[model samples]
Target: MTTFKKSFLILMLPLMAFTAAHKFYLSVTHVGYSEKDDALQITTRLFIDDMEKLLDERYGLKAQLGTDVESKSADEYLEKYFRTKLLFEIDGQPAEYQFLGKKYDTDMLICYFEIPKIGMDKIKSIQIQNEILTDLFDEQQNVVHFKIKEKKKSFVLIKSDTKGMLNL
Candidate 1:
């Protein structure tokens, strides 16, 4: 109950609160070309809580992703959001991908996409633009991994630089 002790406690309370409130925002995406299927497969992993917040904030809907009471239009909004935020270009031509579906993995939401009929011989380079969760989180980072045959490349994309190119 001393004055010095009370002052120190007050000063430390804000610092403790700030430290506890800090969180890291990150997402991981994998893009691989399948020789057998002659297609490009993409998978993105995002934190379920972060994505739920984004769905609510961006679309004014309580998506409640991964929960029993999830919104019915969640998938539609997810596809719409991702279609605008994430993009790809193969050999300098815009590549359109089909949003296959999404699944929940523990604390993450994994989304599946595919660009069919993409032959290995036709791909000289690939450009990726991933802006997932960047608008909602200023410190968001999107880590992308590309695997084409035996070659592999990785990039860490942020709000400022959301695009990367990999050349074979």
Candidate 2:
């Protein structure tokens, strides 16, 4: 190969790969309130590949998430992981999370949870501590969105700031 050709290839290949690849470690957690049910509905979306990696490294659970080769106990592992890594607090008190279920959207695993007996009016301030993937990924970002009644609040938590407080 010519010198110019090799140089151009080397320069463009990494740029192309960087642009094409979207392997950013991120998770989005949405928390909303239900008046009728008096529940705080929560949904967390995580990259399946990222989750699988953590599961393998930390829990030794080989979950082939978002694939046909996924393990049968994938949900169980997910629940366990979330329970350990995610925490919620209302009015400086610990809140319980009911793991509803999960569904996959493309490469993301969207898990659902609910804080029952909690109404929007009753919440003075909502604090969320999400350390998911932070230990594994130094630059991991956990975006938390709260839709309590008509008020909407958002917090972007990084490895350094794993906990976010939103006053509603």
Per-residue CA lDDT of model 2 for 41-107, tens digit only, reads 9999989889999989988989888777888998888899898889999999999989999899998
Q: Model 1: per-residue lDDT, tens digit, 32-65?
A: 9888889999999999999999988989989989
**Which residue pairs show collisions in model 2?**
none
Task: Give model 1's TM-score versus the native structure.
Answer: 0.93
Candidate achieving the largest lDDT: 1
In candidate 1, where is summed lDDT lowest over 10 consecutive residues? 14-23
Q: Which stretches of candidate 2 lie over 4 Å from their true place?
A: 1-22
Q: Using Cα atoms with residue i matched to residue i, what is each candidate's TM-score against the true structure?
A: 0.93, 0.86
- As a whole number from 0 to 100, the lDDT of residue 56 in candidate 2 is 94
Worst 10 residues of 2 by lDDT: 14-23
Score each candidate by Cα lDDT.
Answer: 0.94, 0.89
